[model samples]
Target: MKVILLERIGKHGHIGDEVSVKDGFARNFLLPTGRALRATEANRKRFERDKDDIEKRNQERREAAAGIASGLNGKTVVIIRQAGETGQLYGSVSSRDVADALIAEGFSVSRSQVDLANPIKNVGVHAVPLHLHAEVAVSINVNVARSEDEAARQAAGEDLTAINYDDEANEAFAAEQQAATADLDTSEE
Candidate 1:
């Protein structure tokens, strides 16, 4: 189905551009979201008549998004979750969780704006993109960790996923082996 876009959609046609999309996509998402209208003769004429108004609204939205993006870009949000020793989270972190964390940090954000391709499954810092507007995009850091201290360590560039053995234990084992070697030598003598 062909539709006249009211605003610039990612990879779709710009404002007032007629483009063909899937029928269900047009009916369920584009039309319901008011991002587009069906490309009928009557709708085309109406779009032309009100094109200026639509562009003005789009510009205002873009400007507002730009303002917010300036403040939100590169900001970090901390998320606490339980994880195993290898740093794999018990449960993954979804976009909703990131959005909620941003909201709690006094930012106006929604799950739809978060562009996380997949749920986060590891304990570390992740760069999550956000589509604030059609043209206004920004990224933020999500510090996922088992505790506040772990988050801080991740922020400080520590990789917690690696299996780290205690240095003291290694030293103690080496000392025990040397003593056993000496005992064996004395018995042979």
Candidate 2:
């Protein structure tokens, strides 16, 4: 389907530009979201008539997004969650969690704006992208860990997931000797 975009849609077209897109995309997303209009003669005339107003609104939104992006970019948020010994999270961190963390930090962000490709299932720092506007994008660090101390350590580049073989072996040996001592006492009694 051919449509006239009302604003800049990444990879599609800029405002007032006629472009071809999937019919489902046009009808379901673009039309419903008011981001575009069907390419018809009357719609073309309407677009030309109201093009300036649409462009002005788009510019205002872009500017606002840019202002927010300047302050939001490269910021870090810490999220504490239960994890296994190997640094795997008991529950994965979703987009909503990241949005909430950002909100706690006094940033006005939504889950839709957070472009997380997949839920984070490990404890570490992750760079998450935020699509603030059609033209404005920025990234912030998400520090996921089991505790605040772990988060700090992760931020400082410590690998909490590494297993210490010497400690484990020493612990096992101590446990075996304690068990043997208990058994000898029981036999004597």
Candidate 3:
């Protein structure tokens, strides 16, 4: 369907710009939300009449989004979750969880704004993208850990995810050390 956008809706189109979008999207979202109108002659004329006002509003919104992005970009959010010794979380951290964490830190964010391709299921630091506007997106650090101490270590640049302790490796290293010590003692005697 062809429509004239009243506002910026992601990558679809800018305010007062005529663009084609999915029929379902036009019927269900754009038309109902007053963000767009069908590209008929009358609606086009109406859009042209209100074009300046619509563009002004869109510019204001974009500027606000850019300001928010400037403060949020390069910031890290710590998330504590339960996990086994291997650092695999018992439950996953979804975008909603990240948004809530951000809100707790006094930032205005919504779950839909978090651009997580998939939920985080492991304990470590991850770079998550946040789309504040069509042209403004920022990557924020998400530190997932089992405890406060672990979270601190992760934030301090420690990678515990790759450290897997094996019982056999520990036993072999201990036996080798004992043998070397015994050999030294026997030679001294």
Candidate 4:
């Protein structure tokens, strides 16, 4: 269907411009939303007067988006998670987590802007892309670290299996060590 756009659409056309679009889209969305109207000789003439204003607004929006893109470039975000011995995260990191991390780092980003295929299930550094605008995208670094529990076990000479069984063994060893120390103290006394 031929329609006269009443509003500027993203990277497509400006208000008062005649464009061809699918009939269903024009009827269900554009026409109902007052974004466009059926193209007629009367509407076409009316659009000519408003075309300059629409172009100006579109230019301003593009410039503003470009400025935001510069600030978002090359930013890094870290996600700390509990990981097992095989480097698999105990809980996956979702796009929401990345968005929150960006916000924490003083970046205003939406979850929908994050271009993650799925939840991250492994621990490492990753480059995550954020699609801010249609032409404006930025790559941010994500450093996934092991949680404190995992780190502590690693520092204590333990892996997942070792730590699982070490709980009971550690208690027994502690008791024996304490008893030996007590005997030494008694001898000294």
Candidate 5:
């Protein structure tokens, strides 16, 4: 059957697209779910009006996504995990982790938007691509670092503080402060 999509059925198709599908499938799924309508003259005209509105809304969304992409460009996100001596992670970093990192950084992004082919296994810097829109993709830096403090605490069998993996600069600064304090204590002898 020929139908005009009222909403996007999948990732690619837009609203008001004339697509061919089986009548039974359309009746059972698409029509009932309000994903499409029969391509009659009245519905076609209605679709024409709705198309403009949909396009305008999509444009606004694209613009907002672009702005977010701009803000995220060249920004580094850190994820600290337990690793072996060779830097192999105990567990890999998944899209959900990346999404959570982005969310913590004040960006509202979904896991589905992340385009990672496989979970990160080794610790280092990785370029992660985020698919904000169909044509809009932006690459963000992800640094997976070994949780040194966590590892030390675990080795000594002490209670480990929950390490914040979102900020690399803060962690670096904290290390520097600790070193400075240690130096002052040694010099005060």
Candidate 6:
């Protein structure tokens, strides 16, 4: 289907350009959302009449999206979830969780706007992208950990997985036993 785009679509076409797209795309998204118009003669005439106003609106929307993008970019949101000793979360972090966290931080974002393809299933920092506009996107860090201390360590670039608590406990026990043996020797002397 050939349609006139009302705004710039990334790598697709610019505003006021007539481009060919899939029928399903036009029917399901573009036409229904009013982001595009059918390329019929009458609709083309109508588009010519409203072209200027549409361009102005598109520009305003782009500017607004840019402002929001600036605020969202490079920001991190920490999410604490219970995980086992292996750093695998018992429950995963979904897009809704990220959206809620963003809202908590005073950003008005929807779950659909978060471009996470799947739920996060591990304890680590992830870069999640927010689609502020069709042409504008920004990424923020999402730190997922079992506890606040682990989250803090992750933010500080620490590898929590590399720290073996069992090994540390064994070393402490050995040191205590050796100290006891030394005290026993001193008493015997």
* Highest TM-score against the true fold, candidate: 1
The candidate 3 region of ten consecutive residues with least summed lDDT is 159-168
Ranking by TM-score: 1, 3, 2, 6, 5, 4
- What overall lDDT goes with each candidate model? 0.95, 0.94, 0.91, 0.76, 0.80, 0.90
- Badly placed stretches (over 4 Å) of model 1 are 166-169, 172-189
Candidate 6 ranges beyond 4 A from true positions: 162-189
Clashing pairs in 3: none
Question: Residue 45 deviation, candidate 6, in Å?
Answer: 1.3
Residues 104-160 of candidate 4 have per-residue lDDT tens digits of: 877778898899998888866667888775556778767676765544544444544
lDDT of 2 at 154: 92
TM-scores for candidates 1 onward, in order: 0.91, 0.86, 0.87, 0.55, 0.62, 0.83
lDDT of 5 by residue, 65-159 (tens): 89989888777787888877666789999999999999999997899899899999977677899988665789997777776554444444443
Q: For model 2, how does the per-residue alpha-carbon lDDT over 33-141 read when each residue is reduced to its tens digit?
A: 9999999999999999998899899999999889989999999899999999998999899999999998888888899999999999998899999999999999999
Q: Report the C-alpha lDDT of model 3 over 1-189, residue by residue, as the tens digit.
A: 999889878878777789999999999999998899999999999988988888788788779989989899999999999987788899999999999999998888899899999999999999999988766899999999988999999999998887656878999999999999999999999
On a 0 to 100 scale, what is the lDDT of residue 56 in model 6? 86
Error of 5 at 9 (Å): 8.9
Q: Candidate 1 lDDT, tens digit per residue, 1-189?
A: 999999998898799999999999899999999999999999999999999999999999999999989999999999999999999999999999999999998889889999999999999999999999999999999999999998999999999999878787999999999999999999999
